[model samples]
Target chain A: MNRRDLALGKLRGLGNSIIDDVENNMVPSIKVPSRGTSNIVYDEAKRYYVLGDRYGKRSLGNVKQIKKVAQMVSMGNFCKGLVNTEKTATIREMYYVSEGWDVDFSNQDESNLIVEDLEVTMGISREDLGLMPEEDGASVYGDLTLKDDDVEINAIKSGKSGYSISPTIDEIEFLDHGVERVIAVETMGMFHRMVQEKAYKKFNCLIVGLKGQAARATRRFIKRTHDELGLPVYICNDGDPWGFHIAMVIMSGSAKLAHVNHELATPDAKFLGVTASDIINYDLPTDNLKDIDVLRLKELSKDPRYRDEFWQNEIKKMLKIGKKAEQQSFSKYGLEYVVEKYLPEKLDAM
Target chain B: MNRRDLALGKLRGLGNSIIDDVENNMVPSIKVPSRGTSNIVYDEAKRYYVLGDRYGKRSLGNVKQIKKVAQMVSMGNFCKGLVNTEKTATIREMYYVSEGWDVDFSNQDESNLIVEDLEVTMGISREDLGLMPEEDGASVYGDLTLKDDDVEINAIKSGKSGYSISPTIDEIEFLDHGVERVIAVETMGMFHRMVQEKAYKKFNCLIVGLKGQAARATRRFIKRTHDELGLPVYICNDGDPWGFHIAMVIMSGSAKLAHVNHELATPDAKFLGVTASDIINYDLPTDNLKDIDVLRLKELSKDPRYRDEFWQNEIKKMLKIGKKAEQQSFSKYGLEYVVEKYLPEKLDAM
Candidate 1:
């Protein structure tokens, strides 16, 4: 895709709110979510995508199991063939994001649509959502920096009761202070676990939620809290594609932050989770690993700047085994197994 | 994928002393085949991507269908359960794309490789070459229009030998005479159809090759020929991903042209053959489409410019009777069908 194509592709799914997010500079950098309610949720729902996520209640490599659970939840085959008592579920791409076509919606229900018209069902018509070249240079925020500490000051009350969390820089200034590791979790439920879960207590962590106005507000609070506290946050998310992408949002921010040099929420945050590699690390079943997940693991390994010693080591491990581990597999291991076999070994290694 | 990663992704197979036609200067464009007969054939064989022709062969859409045929050939999945064929042959992706352990030997084997990794393939590890992001911004000569006349130059010398067709602009030489719509086919088989098959008698066009070195040489000759004899060249190839990409490469020259905007190719070329939409339109067997194909179709239709009147009207004809038509399906109509439903009916509508 050329620069123009990239720009148009990025411009897709700019709902009034998302467009405003770009205009107002909320996330600083924004990308088409590979996870978390992407546009595919609406249009591609019927197609039954091979979902992958990196989110969950446990930071115990939950970021690595997103694809495993997503495959179970999103694929048509998984719906009928899946094991009845397993913790995993498959989800179609549309379940999490809107890819623009109402895959399940036939033109019969609406007069404006024609079932046979490829453009209509695919949202490719001239007036409607046609395939635009992907947007490349467009910014998520006017000038938000993924690596910058100076977040823009704008308070808008939203959601039920019109509530907003306006934690001033001064109020959250403690986040910028002395700290060793500031790990961030996307769910309060996970937060509850880290503070309470025996496996996660070894490291200093922060947990936050990703849904609703309250969740956004909490995310803002967490960002400020981490910044002021000077904590190096590690993100722990669900073990699915959606969860994996959500953590990335908190980590690198997005392309819009090309201007910012600081205000990074998690500049060095890594994919700390129950990765595919763990499947072999611990004796777990590997049936749920999809080609895409395997593909993603290889891709992450190939990335130059995105490469890290930890990932390099993990890639070496996968190469040795030719397999990956799913975090959902651990759910079967039981909470006791997680605490005993998984966490202690994992924390010590990290 | 980062810059370096993208550079590596495209260099999958580059060898031989053939100069990089797309890039103006010598870059890591071609890998010299090994020093054996097979090696020389393999090295030189890179050029015969598709067969070549001198005038209208098949269209890009048709070329795509051929590519799918190649993919099926490589995988040995063709006619798995086809009528009259009960024997099954399973194929793997690695066969055609040669990936080595923790890495692809084929990718490693190629030399003078100009293009490298892609952003789409970056998520995988090198050990298995499982999945990774395909490299995105490795600059190449063609992909999109960086130079208008470069496309023309390419058109002229596309099928020639012992010459490289580099787009050059002079004071008042070439512009004095603008060209008209002239079709350029990419295969000798397609060329056979024109002369022996009398395919050209049906339309005003040119011919190139459909395979290897001869095809590349034909393209060079086409571009250079057009320069010596200015003629607006329209392309007709297959419609599958590879075919679409080939057309794109010919149109843009390569991403390497990003540096010099003057000699870039043009984008006015038209697609005339089987397309992803045909799966929906012709009601043809869709099992041939890949998982990503559906998503891509959704993306293509969403482009704003595609929604415009001229393009939309042309695309809309596929639904003339609220039904889509596949080029392959036209075969069912047979040679008689070619005279009846195709040609006059099809081209007239277009």
Candidate 2:
């Protein structure tokens, strides 16, 4: 059977079991592996979190559990309906559906938590259930063709207005591309400048805008291009703790999204950045490092994901300098410096 | 000429003045009132801050001022282009345009600040410049036809999915409807339940979901509906500090958006709420009052906007009781009770 059929069959079995439990006067329950640091093991080699044997169950006995089960059933039915109708919805749209289901979700975070719970319980990805989050934080310009469902388009030749990478990366199939490598930028402003300058054409590379932290789709797309086409991926971001974390997320994947990290991370990607050293080397304009920035840098120094010798030294340098430089600070040199000089030098070194 | 034409004309005049300065080798400068507590006076009568006579200038001499002027010019040009093309963009989109203009806005807040600066400088509203933020928070189910731009929508008759209030409130012209009043709810779940029960029809009133903290557009819409339609507006929220502030925002408007407060605030709107007294009087299920909630309540007790004797007493009682109740707690009585009983009783007293 296809993935959709398998997912639908599992859901049907769950529904039947619940019905049987009700008929037999027994409490209907679902057990899934618990999610947390204690129940999750960090695989050093794979650079991702894997679930442990510890399990948690939701049943109709306790008041809170009853509410949770109701939400699960509501979400399950919602997913089943989506599958039957061949429709897709964002997480925000699903949260709105809570209004009709009498489910009280105080915030988007609560709705997201329930979605994760449902995903764990059903042993299915949210993508398979046809639920996507709002597409954001990723833009691309390249000599590439992408087939999203039935529609196919040449992304690079699509003029100055580049393609916005959709959140549903799994549904998209890369057709053909002649790009040698991908240069992913953390800031949208820098990405736009590069695109406007036609830097992608100059370098024969794909330019991906991360916006801030790279979205799952952007990371997944980078991973796919790198793995399938043997394209070297490079990241460029601000010389700050937040920017460092963004690169880490792109390279090793984030712990917060550990469940689907394997499909979303590009471990082979290298940082071609506005690094801590770049602040002095390029003599870029710097802003005073806030207390929070310092704290974050210190925190990253201790993080396993950021334990690389090069990264550790970079954090130490930033802490000592007490200043951070934005990618936009390259504008202080000249408009063309970023696209013409800085990018070329970085890429040549890579 | 229409508002848009007038705005474009003013923008053109400003652009010509800058050109005149540059042509004559004169240092171009634009002066506007400074924004701060020093330049902002709290008008107790209006319950909002009014701009004072303190002025600041963006001139070509100072490097920082030069940068500011460059950003202003970039934004002005972007706005002029949007007007020329008859296109609307969110503040986020405006920030993306920064790259092409060689202007740096590191974050959305910075972009928003620049937008505010442009508004104060040009004496033109952002809406008039064809800019809009993302529409959110408010949902409406009523016997009302709303004319948004070119489209006319009958809100109540638009099936089960009610109309989400558009962010561009100024453009929305409400058509004739027989609804007597508007009941603005803080929670979507409650709003949905009320709509499902057709409680608005029973009471001959409109129901609007604030969806936690009401969006600026929602507030403006409520104010417009109250003033133009001669509808008595009532607010229902949780017996918590956040909920109380939501009512205050609707009534007096928020300090952050003080410049547009007059157009947004509905001072006559009454709080028909899940007040502290309701927990005891209605015997509603209460949660333990959080420390942050208590702190906020204490802070609001001292604020001029929340100086009503009834409101002060309510805050005092909440602190004394050490309990907070969500509007959703009304569900304990039964799904239909909130619609059939609580609302009717509240409206009758009002």
Candidate 3:
């Protein structure tokens, strides 16, 4: 099924409904999935928030809904225009477009809310509506071929710079590739070093740079790559609470973006390093955990998502030791040690 | 004096001093301007933080200062590279650059600190060091010609879109032009509408957009425009505590950027609207002030920066009314009314 056609069909249906309501002298109403956790149910098996059996109806008769419907109609028209022109817009661009149309988005948050409303109402993602966030997160290098728009990109042959994963992951199509696994690095510095050392060649895996917390597009791409290629995903982050949370976000999904969790999350992705146990076992240089780090570790220890015994023990050890180590700490050994020795050892254990 | 020459000379001096220390078997030391209010004297008449008698010296003998000196040297060398190459870098870019150079900038804040240290130590601003924040805040439309690098830009004649004020404001040289005043708006939407309506032509003033909180560059530009061009500046923001702070940041200077406040703050800039008084006087649509708004309002009521009796009364009245109005609320009077009626009325009152 073509998503553009589906989006266009939704817009046409809305237009017809509005036309019918005007002809019959009736106030039109739009039924959208209600926002927030109240309308979302946590699916334990799926490890994500799915839409609950609850819906919000916006009627033109109500003053607020009248404005809402006007905004919605404007957005629908805008989406229709995007499809017709074969163009894409970032969320910021969408806000500016709506602003130009006099649809009063006082802040980006208001614009985001309407976009979310549109997503729920049409049962379509924003990406399908030709809307994307600013290109952020995920840098890839490995034996993978990707078709971004009309251009086929050979990730492995893209030189030292690697391919920047697009935010519009839905628009990307993967070609047959020989990549065996995917390793996602939290920091760009580490990712660059891995590339410089040609770690991907040795490991027969794609190296994906998360660049701190993984963006939605990065997570989606990772999930798709894993699912489509039957590749195991491994996360390498700092041996800190923040790093643990990053891995948690990839595996179980983030609470803030729970609405799109199932699509974004790679639940089977494994945490490789730098783990708290690795710091002691490898005799890595450590820095005293700051007050904030301790607080975060304590919170993560109490979090249900981190209830696994290994994770619990790691957090406990970090708290007890009052120290943390970064992925860069492996640089103390040598530049090549992280890619050559540390990563190889971790993979062997796995 | 050329800032690059000054920066390079300072770097050379530091290098020679270290060499001298090694020869003499003495610990190397550096004197930098001490941070915080304790070392910052608030100049009431000037409305900025001036360096006090106290200065902080980092020495190799001290464990903490050793790390601080190392970070500072790394940053200084990085700035030297930027100057040598005649290139500009955003704060984030500087962080990444430092990471590439093996400087441990774990986060942006750490990088920001080193930048600040360089500023204080060398008696030079980040802008002078060829460092800028990301391009943000301030859009402009006026009878003004700006020389950004070699490209000449006529703000008034630059098509209907107007000119976005660049983050590298230091590089912008204003050509001889006639403009009565500068009106800096709080939001981009309002600024765009004002441009669309040709409000600048009607009022014979330069319109500058401060998108939400004004960025340092925007503030610096506003200040320089006021100083060099001798234009009275007027700030128009929402009638909320945050809006009040934005105005405060413009007039009295922010504590975080105290060192560069004198260069950035337009002390004579007047707050035009939307004021709490305007809510009552104009009978504007008001939303119930959230807990955060109330809390901010309460804090502003106690802050020295907001000590103006009129400003105090306005905040007090907002707390009493339990309501706040956005700048967008003027849309109730229609789009053209803000430019034609409300602005004229406010200007008349001024």
Candidate 4:
């Protein structure tokens, strides 16, 4: 049988075309594990198969077309054989997986491939990679002693070049001076706004969300900052619930990730700037007050784990005022207000 | 032993709260198949007993969170006294498969949980009464749909209703009316904007895409739309390839649902409007075009499946223009201009 028929018609029809790819030499841009079978030959024990055969007996469709599987693992490997044989290694900056077969209102059930994680694997070492690090992903930092001695640090250390991710491990290095801190902003849109106002060079900021989910990834990075570099971390989020939840997830740890990796929050770092205080502190707009945010705050406070000191106190402040504050509320403070109110004031302490 | 320590902790730390929830309630929010003993039970197969009665006398997390060997069946008819009370009834949705150790990612991975289709019931049936659809934890369209069609649908659809879901099945009927055309916009924010412009109310536009990521569920609704209402559908999407592909999925069908149900989109339906043509026709901004999106369009033009007539002509147009068009590009034309440009000027042909 031809490879296409063997891979599709005979092999239970994954309809994968990587079989022709393996034969023709289609190299993937990302890295695939040097070991393990391609999606071809299923493994009952591991519950998935190496998509293609390492022996060249089987074929894989082009790795790019295969969405559901961890194609990057196969792509970067086979791509070396296809496009470049001189270098066998390729680094992975992101990994996407599906929640699977997204069903819609129109009877269109396409595969729902969500970007699972966008980790900085280029600089991660196997030694640095823990089997299940107290966290799922690992973060690295340069240990440094900065100029500021009196200001207390409350976040993961900052001060790394984020011109873009360095492609190789060897290219990854420590910053020459420690005057600035590298605060990974999850979204580039937010970063651009911050930079337009000169928010980060003043404190050493690293723009993160340019490629990944940006928000959750930054939290993990900051936690890594805490562990690897011992930088104090603080979260400046919108006073609204979604923003609050994102910040809280960093603080409380995701239940899903709790099973997978570590949480990144200071035992003491707290949500700053976007507070009910911002509503009164800056006389912000109340049209933005959402009923759900109020409801969510009440729900969060009632949770047994958060009923204690920090959350309850913050929640009670809003309950007393019956107001909601959002990170956007600080925008009225203008770029200068954000820096002075939260960032610079905090940096001055640093 | 604490419930968690039992069964050698095989299903350890996996949604443990779900088990404690079962301990207190008989018909828990999630109804799991009984991990009963193997006595050649439900299907009258080779009746065997467990190594011990450990499988039969199981609880999600009671005296001990033990799942008996009996609980590991591909089919559930063998067990007696399942809480949902199915004697000959097939397993429709598995609540907490004692064996669901990993993430449920694909149709095939999920198929493994079922011994056979005969062992499980399929589709919504009159028999599945008294049970809330959401209780099954299966995908459900559960929210309100504002009747205004001009509103940028995606924006309101983007609103968080403390849920990942939007618009229940009952809600769709309210909007269907005598409308002759159904346009399922995958992005709702754009739909809401159109509503503000009085596009739907003015021109009888039936815009979908109030829910993101529920593409599969949305597809089911489309099947209902076509089968129940003979509306000629037209998919309006971003000019990029994924948008093009999503339109293809709605019309041509996807492999994942090929076996389960067929015929959501009609063969005669049109794939119209908001494609790469907008980049040149309207001069839309490229500032926010994701790099990956540009690459995907390039790849789409090259793929053999898409190289044929309609796709080829459209893709070539984009390449010639060298620009990507987002749905928002239509904003320049205003709702009136879009209807003037894309919609059939005469609907009497219908």
TM-score, model 2, chain B versus true chain B: 0.93
Q: RMSD in angstroms, all models?
A: 27.5, 9.5, 9.6, 25.3
In candidate 3, stretches whose alpha carbon ends up further than 4 angstroms from where it belongs are: A1-350, B9-27, B99-108, B157-161
CA lDDT, candidate 4, residue B199:
49
Query: Which of candidates 1 and 2 is the stronger one according to TM-score?
Result: 2
Model 3: residue B192 alpha-carbon error in angstroms: 1.8
lDDT digits (tens) for residues A1-350 of candidate 2: 86679779878977887999889998888776688878776678887655667888888876778887888788888888877765555575566556556876776688788888877777777877867664442667788887765556555543333465655566677889989889988865666567657788898889987878776667888899898889988888888999888988888887666677777778888998888888889887778899999989999999888777888888899899999988867755544677888988877886
| lDDT by residue for model 4 (B85-194), tens | 32111122222222233322133234333332211222221112111121100111112232222221211222111112221222223342545566655454344334
Tell me the tens digit of each residue's lDDT in model 1 across B13-114: 221221243254432222112222222111122221111221222121354334322222222111211111211110121221222122222322231121
Tell me the tens digit of each residue's lDDT in model 1 across A225-278: 455545554555544344555665455443322111123234445556655456
Between candidates 1 and 4, the one scoring higher on lDDT is: 4
Q: List, for all models, the DockQ compared with the true complex.
A: 0.01, 0.04, 0.04, 0.01
Error of 1 at A264 (Å): 3.6
Docking class of 3: incorrect
